[model samples]
Target: MLSGQSFMMFVVLLCTCAFAFLNGFRDASNSIAVAVRNRALTPTYAVLVAAFFTFVGTMASTSFGVYLVSAVELGVPDGIPGLALLLSGLLAGGAWGLFCWWRGLPISSTHALIAALAGASGASALLGNDGVHDAWRMLAGGVLLPLLFTPLFAFAASWVLVIPVTWLVRHSTASDVNGVSRAGQAVAACAVALGNGLQDGQRTGAMLTLALVTAGAAQPGAIMLGPQLLGAGCLAAGVLFGGWRIAHTLAYRLVNIDPLRGMVAQTVSAAMLFFGAMLIHLPISTTQAVTSSIVGAGTNQRFESVTWQQVNKVLRNWLATPLVCALLGGILYLAMHPLVS
Candidate 1:
């Protein structure tokens, strides 16, 4: 017979996997949105390439994974309460992700999950758990600040990047520029997909690692390959499932992006992701970076072609994601307190 603790751990892992899948499903478009819009690659091929590169990125490094575990582990309670908290946060984050996807809005899963965890931590404090004190502080420094600025940085970088790219090709014919940019966009798409895997892959792996430590199956700071592979596989599968609604919103609704602009946006976004993962050890949203870059690049060409209403809608969702998921997580944790406590 399975022990109660083991059962709880199993439940947490199951929720984690489901959340990972939903994450991939929602974020799948981040890498390929601009590429597809510009016809750099077919929808089918774009997804396949994105999935492959994402998996590779997920397994590439653990620096960000280690940082995530440390940051979040500080806030979670010990033992069963911790497992319950994690479960609640995952459920809340995953639910919010689906809601946004259904609405065809791309919000940051990274922000949602961290905010959910912080909310669950607050609930734990209400239940007299002492580990919740630094939750918000850690979240602010680690996730919020980075997320807040990433989009702006991506926007500026992508917008600036186009100037140099265009200058180099100034002498080239329109056909030449389009042809080169199409191939460049394809490569850049894979790069962004890889960066997505690196950042998002760490979130799932860190969550699983935290659960294992809570369940006494592993030690803190010791990330295992099994969990990494599992997280990568689930994420890659989510990418394969594809989030066409969100993709369409990005590719078709947000802005009109040519091959040149698309390539620059994707490349800049991918560079930002890599920087966040490797050097800064922050979990920035691929969606925010990619979306902002696309818009920024598009604005440089024809400001009228960019859709402000759709941009406002996405921005509203971005602002709302953290608050809504936090409240939802707190509610779920309070509801689960009776059973777990």
Candidate 2:
């Protein structure tokens, strides 16, 4: 016998977990694409390593959860309406993720989620006396800016980092360089998985927490272990099971990645993502970061070596996904508002 609020909250929590699972499934390539492409690790082992590190990262910290909760609150005030907004956003994001995964496109689930949330918040505001302008402003300032800039930073950073690494290793024997690169690839893969788990897991955790608070099932400050574990576990399973399609696109279609290039690209992307998520408190897209870093790393060999067509497709998807999800989110929120309100 659950109360109406409690039932709705439970639904929202479930949706949040589902969204996280999709995030893991779609972005698993972000962590292991280079390693797989370079044959540094077998696909099975690479996924296992990614899953293990993802779980570890999720359990390691709650800081990202806190930041995401605060950001959502800033855009959509907490209550029943806020819960509705969150649910709408999660649905929109998840739908877009599934579509992209099916199409073997490595779009950013992070951008989808952020854009959906913004759209839902705008719709929620519309139902009330407050206009949608403030919500849009908050989203633009807090989430959109970081999402837009972090990939560029990762691209530039990876390009710069690869040049020096290339010079340093130029004199080494091919065998020696290969050995070092294989080892580095493993390490960088772990870091990327860990960073993804922390950033994405925390987002799901924050959504669950918000739902609980809205339902009066928990206080604002109370952190629940159950939701955290559920989110992390689901994400790990998603990584294990549903990553192959996007993995192929990323590993084979983007660029011909050698062990050295893979190592450099993964290392740069992981470092940038960790810095953005932990220090800058931004929910940057690991997918976009890694993709851009791959481009940067490929540029070291020659611009012609990179598949510009595939890169163009990815870039187009990245720009379109958010806008499409935002529109869908707004429509869903508007439709659900009367019932929820």
Identify the candidate with maximal TM-score.
1
Residue-level lDDT tens digits of model 2 in 1-341: 97667777878888988888888888788898888878788889988999999888877657553355443354345567767877888899899989988889988776787788778876766666332236566466545686688768877887788888989998999999999999999999999999888777776666677677766667766446877788789888888875788888888888876788889989988887688677877776788888888888877775466888988998888878868988889999999887876
Q: How high is the lDDT of residue 106 in model 2?
A: 89
RMSD of 2: 2.2
TM-score of 1: 0.96
Q: Please, what are the lDDT tens digits per residue for candidate 1 over residues 23-121?
A: 888888999887887889999998899999989988885645435644245645567888888888899999999989998999999888888888888
Off by over 4 Å in 2: 63-66, 75-79, 129-134
Instruction: Say which candidate scores most in lDDT.
Output: 1
Window of ten residues with lowest summed lDDT in model 2: 65-74
For candidate 2, give the lDDT.
Answer: 0.79
The TM-scores, one per candidate, come to: 0.96, 0.92
- Residue 225 in candidate 2, Cα distance off native in Å: 2.9
